[model samples]
Target chain A: MVFDKKKSPYLFLLPFLIMFFSFWLWPILQSLYWSMLEWDGLRAPTFVGFRNYIKLFSEQDYIIALSNTVSAAIVYIGIMVIVALFLGFMLNSSILPGRAAFRTIIFLPVTVSLPVIALVFFIIFAKNNGVLNNIISTLGFGRSIDWLGDPRINLWSIVSLRIWRASGFYAIFILAGLQSIPEEVIEASIIDGASGWKTIRLIVLPLLRPVIIYVIIASSIWAFQLFEEPWILTRGGPVNSTATIAMHVYRNGFQFFQLGYASASAYVLTAIIVVFALIQLLINKGK
Target chain B: MKKVLTAAAILLLSFGFLSASGAEESKAEGPIELSYWGWGPHVVGVNETISPAFKEMYPDVTVKAEALGPWDLMDKFYVSMVSGKGAPDAAQLVRRVSEKYLISELLYDFTGFMNEYDGQFSEALNRDVLSVDGKYLGIPLDYGPSALFYNKPLAEKLGIDVSTIVTWDDFYELAVKISREYPDLYIMTQYYPAGTWGSNYYRMFMQSAGANIYDAEGKVIRNNQKMVEVLEFLYKLHADVKTLNIPVNDPLMWEESRKNNILFYPRNSYFSGEMEQQVPEMDGVIHTIPWPLWSEDDDPQYTGNWGGVALVVPQKGPHADIAAEFCKFFATNVEALTQHWYTTTGVPSYAPARDNIIKDNTNETFAKGLMEAITVREVGPWYYTDWAQTEKILGDGLDNMFGGKLTPAEAWQWTEDQLIKILGR
Candidate 1:
């Protein structure tokens, strides 16, 4: 059914278009404008013209947090997507029993609220009598490690926790993707005497490329703004090792009341994320 | 979209009505609404408990008491006062707020309130509040004379005598002994922030040694050889004792850290409630002893914080008389405040409140804690007492020494560099 040339193309979309403009579209434009100004969220904004961006260099914490965020995005997405794919394959396989029970267990973290996960994990990672320390001490180490205290191990600690908490959600996405793969294709590949390993590598992996690409792009975008986990877990301590760009933006905006500076950081973050996504897309296109 | 506009209109109308009600209900002529800010689950609980009574007595007058939590509440209040809106009628100020918050004109000078209530308040409260700028800022709500909290079970387990642990050397020896034996849990600890270096080690210990970090006026008189000795000694403790917390991976770590991991911390009565919140299992094991026997004759006894929350009537607020009345009533009411303290589950600032709570108190859990409150000491803050130097110069200097950024002698030089920035004289 082709639209009549006389009919208004936007007539059907007017309500949603208004909503999109008001809620999503306008805020983005406003944020972009505010990013250049030195506004404290209360007073009239002063146009600083990239001074906030320049100060980002002197801020040791912001620089460290930026690196931490980049690393988290790469590591979290890499492991989570791969593990999710593998879990999807295993869950759907005939070799696995009680798929319902297995799926429920694996998907538990996805259903759990992020704050709840943070609280539970914080309890588990407590430096002294926490479950982890109990296990470690039982191994004859005879000491509790400063899991959140020592600057060296703090960021890695957040990374491991993020992976544990996020992988299950990714698992569901990949599982749906796996289930969507045609049974007839696998049957034909099997009839052609493609080994199981060879089939997964050559046929299934390449075939699942679109779904995998979707998963990576979507998950990486979310991962780039990782905040709550690091914020709650370490509060950007034992000395700013786990501070992320989003966390810095949040603190400066809310706690420090430096709204303009926070906006600048956010805009820069958006730029970084866009560039990363573009480069990944370009590489995938070349591949 | 038009529906949304109508809804926005309705919301704006409702907000307008709210502001109108706020203005209308506010004191027009008699007994105005006094908005006060303070902390202590007790103060919060006390305000709630007393509200019925307060409102009952002053039917026309209303007092809104806002209670903020421990860590960032002060900072939030400072940001508000600086930004110029939504401030309470009166605010709870720390003794060091003069420097921490350098607003000269905004804060109400409570010299009049102090003079009027001089007869009503306790001598200790008056001394602490009156000492700052020799002018009072606010009325007293609660006090926080910190003591050395100990684990009785852990102490018994180690066969330690609390009596002998008075001097820095004596405390150090016991820590070494505890470390050698336990090896896993920390023997003694405090949070390693750059700010508390002078308070915990220098001022507190110096006060014990009978010295003050500064003179009556802000001066760097604390740069003595003994100060160097304490800083060096504490930096070495960072190496000797494992800090109460380990890495962030272990789940039970904070509980154990709050409970069995650390033997002692230089904290106030607030720690009692916090410890209970964090580790109820160690309730019986925890005990508070007076800040371990400081010798304060020779040194300016570093009794920095007597922990009082002041109630003030803002010069601009609608209800100055009502706010003052509430302040007077709340301060004098020992029974109501005792309940507030118990329910807030903290050490009461007033001596009578502590005595009332401890008298025939059947809950054996916090009984010994009640005793710690019973032995009230007045080691409060020195106002205009900018801790910036002690905090920046002395505290961060300790961290720097620990990080191997500066040696003990070089730390002295480095501290001198920071002294100028923090003190600016």
Candidate 2:
């Protein structure tokens, strides 16, 4: 019997296709459908026809959550890129003593569990007896600051946590990009009377563009979905100051049982992330 | 071609075998196993006390009670209900949020069983909280009868007699005196400008004044005089006495209480367990008193509820009847409830069981306060489907008030307007 190559290939792909369709594609389609209904997860759904989406736009909490998520993401990506790049350059320096030790120390937070880190930060940011406040007081600071309680500073605190957890991990990626740059290119540039800063600005940064773009896009996506840290630390509190779109989705779906509304919020979040990633890609391509 | 066909046949046979194995396991006859889900001390009660008692009553059946985080338990249960699989036969659900499930029609109707056990549980809990269209969907496990948890040592040190505080006016005066004398120590911690806990605190005061976010008819009463008054009192407490601005449930607040920096804490009976667990050193140092009345002339001052849980049997569970029976037994059996009390330190909603459970001085004080303050037939607000949304709106308004951006009346009006716009009610 002759085995038809086309049919054989189709058969080979069948299992993966089935799994993907069942798990990923089906859920996305179902969520999209549910986004237009007014169901409470178990109740018979009513055809709401974008009513959930309309309501979401008018809801102040959702607006605040969207603003917080976008602002935090922008700040997070900006700081993470700069800090990671700096750390990456420092680690890549041959003249820097204990380079391996410094890399390990900086990258340690990446290996630590996020909940543990958030909890540790919770203690550190405690208003009265926290480590940070204690240090401030010892340094003759007049009073303890309510780091996690103040609405103005709470979102920044969450951003600091995101940066701390991820900067080291991204720095390793940056370090890899730096290592991939041939040593000869740098040596030739220096031989041709190029300053160190000039070489990095004109050569290293351009070459490192792909890694930086990837980091920015990945961090933006992650920031839009930020939940566990703020949840464990502040629970998006001090008046929803740090509530993210993902947190709003969980609240609507699980806490409020507004599954349809939650699905709508989720789709909006997806759109935002997509638009953000596309903008970054377009900018990179333009450059 | 032959090799591929053989591999496909083997895979098909393996799938068939696995399917057959699952079917056989389902069909296997033995002792019936019922899964129960709960959280916190109630889960402990179910696993250690209630489940054992249940098994003793039904020797042919076994009960497996799984303890999960409060939010995790609800999330898992809701998912299981929606998927129609892997749900616990019986689960403990918070009374406030149970309305969402009740409206979903996914809960087993316990009306018949509830009727049989009528007059056994507290009338306040059974009135309309767990009922929908006259169908009882859950059995009341406990009630969070509210009270004041005061630091006895600190009160004595400040020469303040908690017994003399009858009205909120007296309480406020005492708070001011404490602020004047001990500037470093706060009279109480308040969750102003915070999330659900702040809303809860605001609601507690509202209930104390015989007002709530909704009336008995389920209409919005959030902008009423009583609500504004509650907010006004809270604002005054914060502005004048300089109450520690922290969530009562926060670890920082508990730490402050442990350090004797907080002189008083208004909380429900469920906090009795929390106090013992969170601040064990304050076992004797802390004591309970009835919550002060809203005014001197307020008749039959009602205690406010903070948190309570009820046992529910899901309609989709494998053994609905058995689960319902188990829930009834767990809730109404004096012996099981006595065990529950020992394990949870909770005030049983079953009135008869309340008498059987032994208590320490603090718990006794809490119980006495509950009996005295719960004189009114109805206790607290009936949490509706939009309760979570209401909480967010109210919390935001409280934050504004505490932030000095809005007055109490302005905040109350803003919250009501926002609620009307969002909830369309």
Candidate 3:
């Protein structure tokens, strides 16, 4: 081999490029190829053109999965952002004693394993002898509501868990944003006879937009890919009310063994994620 | 530094080339090593006993057994099978999830091997599960025939002769009587809307009623009159009578329910061992019985099956012969079956082995009851193929009915439409 010292830097990049192509780039390309086939994962992948995509679009379960995911992302993102901001502000506020302790308490959920947390919540939300249901029954409700069993309430149950688990992590970022705000700016607002709420509305809120946007984007992405919590808690049941699109992907790929169809669903999910992310970016740009 | 770097580059290139060529060396075998994949702790323990026994029969063929959870096994199978790499020579596939892979035709047909056994295997599995168009796809390892496990103490306390409750209606009457006496107690903790309830018990009830959610051809038959009648019957029993209690899936809660509250649980015989393991307090109190019928007149004497695993050889693997022999040995040989049974808590799929077991151990009423129910009826061919999908649809309907979102009639409609949409009817 001809050696050139100047080109050796490019040689240094070769290993990384090879790994990237082998692992990441190759799989994406392979996925695209598999998406157009009729494969059950074991047999030779038969070319089906666009039929898998067409079939996916027509499936009610897919629609349910998508709608459930989208609704969850919207609701969870909205609530998470607000709660995160409040906690962030509280943790960042100089007047609040034991702010570190409060931050630690809030962050505890984010640090705990998702499946473990889900198991704990599954117990707390069981129809009979559950912590919450027992409390409800003791408070004069004749019968305990099946928190995880009732379709109407189950999605909200998952949403509550998502919010509880996510708020702390989001708040940490928001807290960073809170800290970054110039102390002089708040002092000036207070000197101008602005009330605490008014100052927060005018100053903190405006300055925290970028971090809030980041939080929203990250949280929405997490919400869209919600799997373990609902999977462990309900297995996407009480009907398909809690079945997220990712769960559908998993069910198709693993359970049903429809790899081609699953790949199509996956690409569509990727497109959805891209579109949502782009929308967030466009909104941020517009602002 | 440059000399060292140049040497390193050459060494790396040589290593890659060596590895690429080293793949061919796998063919250079003195002893055939067959890789057998299975799941759960039982897989390892069972294989530990079976491997040596298998080697004793065929000393030249070495067995390499591995275990993973059911889902993980599927995952590994997918990764290996799809890429045409790392495929196990044989695997213990969960029968419920095995049908989808049959379409791939990747499994080595065991019809010849099964014929070699010639009536040694369980008759019901030979007819229903393993056979596809006169070809056997795999050899059955074991089966989980559904049976009713009741708390004898609870039944005695209530003066309920559970054995006399031949029909489901009679069982419901027993439930009502018990509930009248003890308002807090329920017949069982049914996992509703979803869970094993839809997968196991509902299917058992439907089969006992001479109707299944899907026909043999994988067509939706949920709207069949028998199916509708059964749904209505269960609806009334669950909704009106309110016999089910504690709709939860937690092990702790399950332990509590089995120990204290629930009276009658219709589960598979596979759970008989686990019952004692899970709640040791209920060890002597629990007894197994044949699943109650919808009516005395219900014919074909059919029943439902729960979880089971089967051994299959992958066609793409190098050692099909050794894998097939291993599968045959495990499926047919009395020694291997007995070892598998004792080690893994598995009931042998081989009739002779099963007979030997039942004959030798007459005291385990659960196993004896399971043996009697085993040859009766297995799941329809389409059951495992579309299991997850069917479960979701039927599960939703069940949820709707029990959650008070829809009446049984409306839930039936929902299930039918959903199945139609999903199954492309």
- Native contacts retained per candidate? 0.04, 0.40, 0.55
Q: What is the TM-score of chain B in candidate 1?
A: 0.76
User: What does candidate 1's lDDT look like per residue over B242-335, in tens digits?
Assistant: 5553222223344555556667765555556656655666657777666654443424333434244555544445555566667666765776
Sorted by TM-score (best first), the order is: 2, 3, 1
Which one wins on DockQ?
A: 2
Backbone clashes, each candidate? 40, 0, 0
Q: Which one wins by lDDT: 1 or 2?
A: 2
TM-score per prediction, in order, is: 0.74, 0.90, 0.88
lDDT of 3: 0.74
| TM-scores for chain A over all candidates | 0.91, 0.96, 0.93
Model 3 ranges off by over 4 Å: A1-6, A94-98, A182-185, A191-193, B1-25, B31-34, B58-64, B103-105, B193-197, B213-223, B241-249, B298-300, B342-345, B362-388, B400-425
- Which wins on DockQ, candidate 2 or candidate 3? 2
- The better-scoring model by lDDT among 2 and 3 is 2
Off by over 4 Å in 2: A1-3, A111-116, A123-146, B1-28, B103-105, B157-159, B192-194, B358-385
lDDT of 3 by residue, B1-425 (tens): 99669746855675586458645234536678888888654566545777878888888877878878666787888777666678899988777656666642677888777888887776656655556778888888887677777777777887777668777888887776776778767667566556434445576677656676666677776557777787788777776453454333446445455547778777776666555445655556777677777668766556667657788888767887778888887777776676555444467778888778766754453223545544444443224436766766777787777777887778888888888887664
Pairwise DockQ winner, candidates 1 and 2: 2
Model 2, B1-425: lDDT tens per residue? 88679656755665566456544124225689888888776676677777788888888777888888777888898898876667888988877667777753588888888788778777767764688888888888886767777888888988888889888899999889878988788788776445555677767777778876766766677548878888898889888985766545666677677788888887776776777666767767877778788876777667687757788987856687888888888788887776666455566888778766533323443223433343332465444446777777778888878777789999899888887777776
Candidate 2, DockQ score (0 to 1): 0.37
